[model samples]
Target chain A: MEPQLNLVRLKTMYEKMVLIRKFEERIIELVQEQGRIPGMQILANGQEAVAVGIIESLNAEDVIVSNHRSHGHLLAKGADPKYLMAEIMGKSGGVNKGKSGTLHLAVPEVNALMTSTVVGAGPPLAAGAAFAQQYRDEPNITVVFFGDGAAAEGSVHEAMNLAALWKLPLLFVCENNCWAGAQSYSQHCSIGNIAQRGIAYDMPGEYVDGNDVEKVYDLAVSMTDYCRKGKGPALIEAKTYRMRGHGENDHQHYVDKEELVFWTKKCPIGNLKEKMLKEGLITEDELQVVETVSKAIVDEAVAFADESPFPYAEEALDDVWVK
Target chain B: MAQLSFGQAVNNALDLAMSMDESIFLAGEGIGVSIHYDPNMPSHGLLEKYGPKRVKDTPVSEAAIAGLAVGASCMGLRPVVEIMFLPFITLATDMLVNHAGKLRYLSGGKSTFPLTVRVKAGVNFAAGCQHSHNLEAWLAHSPGLKVVFPSTPEDAKGLLLSAIFDPNPVIVIEEMGLYWGKGEVPEGDYRVPIGKARIAMPGKDCTLVCYGGATVTALEAAAILSKENIFLEIIDLRSLVPLDRDCLLNSVKKTGRLVVLHDATKFGGFGAEIAAIVAEDAFKFLKAPIKRVAAPDIPVPFSPTQEKFYKPSARMVVDAVKSITG
Candidate 1:
């Protein structure tokens, strides 16, 4: 009595998750070996389902303002991994001509407002975008991505308050990854869940198991629809964990080993693969093909990045103003 | 031409811009709420005209308001936001400086932020330390931002129009004290170009350069100096970011003396930048050492007597000019 699933779309989602995992794994290798990426790389190893689920629900015209840990979101939003890799490697061929590097990846062509390195900065930007969309009576919605750490920021509260007050079409997606760097959620947040904060803004808040990509996708679709209907903003707390350290530079001594083992067992990609196989939505061979395609994409991206050239020293002075 | 106060001129400009460009809307504290606040604050009565969607009366969240403006601008809407007091802009510097100012550059010129942030500068009727601040120096120092501090009612109307049309983010600094000052304003379709300075008066002895709240002080000092036959040229630098160095240097070159004036603190103020520009670029043209008439390096005191001493008045400008030209 399982619900019918589109095998083609399920395969696509699986491939994207694979691509994200492989892309992050390659970036870690690059950072370790050649020091290619600028700044610390915050890999979305286990949080791929949250980004893939939410972004899949959005139209190409809808805007997404991402936070520091945004690689998975960028990839899910149709950013070519080649340019992203080149940008991470600080090459001229990158999306921002390597001016932004890892923390500030941007692709305006797909309504991807540049990623903000500052904690809790994206929500206000999202609020602004949503306000514009609503003012113009455009049916587009804006989704702002933040972490458990950003839930405590006053900017987030102010932005949510404005979104509610104005009845803007905005979706606040909080990826509760259990830790803000070495600090655990128990220490950083008083509330057990970030979704509960949405009540303060008078918006519908929901929680989903981030490891279950299907549940996340269903919830994201509902929330995005709710906001787009002019019912004001909505909040979603996807309970998840950063399987890796906060950033590549973090030693991660604060997290208990038992907690890590528990989350690792609830791996999103693995869970999805098991579900699909159980339902006969995808065979092991089909899943292997998806994995192979993802690996090829990441490999091609790395090759393109390695072949890409660095920008000229004088190029730094460019792009500051528009005539 | 019709006579209008500085605040009326600003209201006229907003009304004109909104009439022409439906994309231009107002968002700020006290923008919607009418009655207690007077016409001197341009945002009064706007809510009735434009309704809630166009005239967004926001909560007292400076950061969110600024961020909303910048975000809307990026989406191709011209948002004119108000930061009630200049000092309160500190709460929103992250959005104004980091996001709004750098979005164009960081996005590799793919995005444009056409945001007009209207802030009132200088002391406002003993509004106290928190409210009374003319922090043009802080805004001018930021790259990717255009800072305009208009003194006259005419300039207020024209410059605000220009700031709205500007593709980048602009901080329009209005002087609270100049709100009621009346002057002839062009009836319609006016724009005072940014990055330009106006020569208020021509003279041969020394040049008095100032802008914002201090422009009135320079004009007042010009009148006194005229009576004394000092013949001090007065330069009102309407735009601070571009600095109007050519206009400033040319005036100094003609008069052979320079006296920069501002309401900001003397140390590390905008006057220092103007002074350095003259010292470096127009040093050969100077007849005497460059002097700056500015507020002392201290917070605006609450007591009127202490504030009077803290603020740089027309007397200070006159004294600085006498010391330099004597």
Candidate 2:
């Protein structure tokens, strides 16, 4: 039997996954409507399990730095979907006052840190956050989420080298989502898995089926614990895929139809629900109740976002300096 | 008060600041190690004093070094990082410009990022074009960043302390030529406010404005002009980003003449900003056309003979002042 979390916490995780799916689906509608979210939207529709699993093993203090595709991770870290919705819509009530559209949302209150828009810019920032934790002799670690395309960036290599050399408490989580803005991993990388690149830094790392939350969580527990124990940085390649285009703007004319169908069958939420039911972990009514709760939460989030006001035009000149 | 070299004053400021705030730490390439180590530079003896954790020595990664500062600053630590030289700041500009300089603004004034980038400017040691070019103009041009270049050992200590504690990203340019130059610096906790300028020498005929090691050039020119009974008031702009326009305007209003000088190339140099400020704000006070003394628009040469020609000399400043004050 798979070692499972308590039923309540496991069901909460299921609820969060559904909530993220609904939140993303709502955002797609907002983007389609056009004037609500002015900028480009990058949604993580099929990668909910990876974020939920990693966040399950993390503490409140673990600093998280993410990339452009960060809505799922933000939600997993307990970000209020309402402020996040307001933020993406350029409203004043956002966590960041709408200064960071969807691309750079930083909910510092939850230790979510900043979300960098640049492709490979997050690793170095994570290294620095990790360095600070280690310097303070604190047990808390830093987790940076990057994609496979970032693996090819020299900044990522430099960050890895520094983290290993200094024995910083850092976890390099590479969410290998198959494609980086429409360019497949095969085209961007010379190797099959990015986690193997850790060998050059003399750091231990491996890959896992990111679609399987239990498997990813089992590894995340060990990897984050390894970093928290002051054993230096660790790398993990969460092999996953986004069911949608890189951004809502693109059409997936380049994707293979058969491959998409095969992956869609491995849907994380559906698979987890099937397992839970097979083992009698949850009843169909309980699962349906969770979905209903998630939909209500997303409904409130959208209402809050719609009611929020846009920031003043002159507010742009503020916040550059302190005193 | 204590007499200290410009280099020692920097070391003193860092030492004092670290003693006061445990959050302040140092990280750079060969920080206290032999490669970038010299007993006189700002980071010397820091490793032995703070130990390995606080004074981190890292691999040759400029981007990571700056990114480290940006990350650490957000984590309630005031990280004082080194970019080695002005030219190498290019390697680190992405972190400074994209993250460090913008994160706070992006944070909607809700967060504070306190970090300092210590860089050497105003050519010395014949380190060639890559190592010797003064790139203060590049840093000063980037918004949300404060830039400072100390002309005196006193200002060196005060400005560095202020830069470290300032609740924003600041670039402290330690003029390489003035490292060993001696002046009186306060013992501890002295802070020269950012966005402030100091009048290096008081006079009446002309306002000679300059920064970094060029302050010495301006001073030398002042002495020469004084001998000929043509007094030139000197304005050493300690900070650049906040560009002390009031200081320049008031001095020019009194002197009725202006001469901007620096060791950087004339085109698009920070001196151009000073010239523009005077022309825009203090133009009515001018009795003659404003003059500028700066290096010619060319790469700083590798050869010492060529390097001397590349820098603006004391004679250049004197001539520049005479053109406006004659």
lDDT of each: 0.89, 0.89
How accurate locally is residue B313 in candidate 1, as Cα lDDT from 0 to 100?
86
TM-score of each: 0.97, 0.97
**RMSD in order of candidates:** 1.6, 1.7
Candidate 1, which segments miss by more than 4 Å at Cα?
A: A1-5, B35-37
- CA error at residue B234 for candidate 2, angstroms: 1.2
Candidate 1: lDDT over CA atoms? 0.89
**Tens digits of lDDT, candidate 1, B207-312:** 8888888888888898998888899888999999777888988988888899999888889999899899999998999989999888888888888888888888
Q: Kindly report the docking quality category of candidate 1.
A: medium
DockQ scores of the candidates: 0.77, 0.75
The TM-score leader among the candidates is 1
Give lDDT: candidate 1, residue B191. Answer: 99
* Model 2 per-residue lDDT at B2: 88
Candidate 1 residue B128 C-alpha distance from true site, Å: 1.0
Model 1's TM-score against the true structure: 0.97
Instruction: Give per-residue CA lDDT, model 2, range B7-115, as digits (tens).
Output: 9899999999999999999989877674655666888898899988788888899999999999989898999999988999999998998898888887777667899
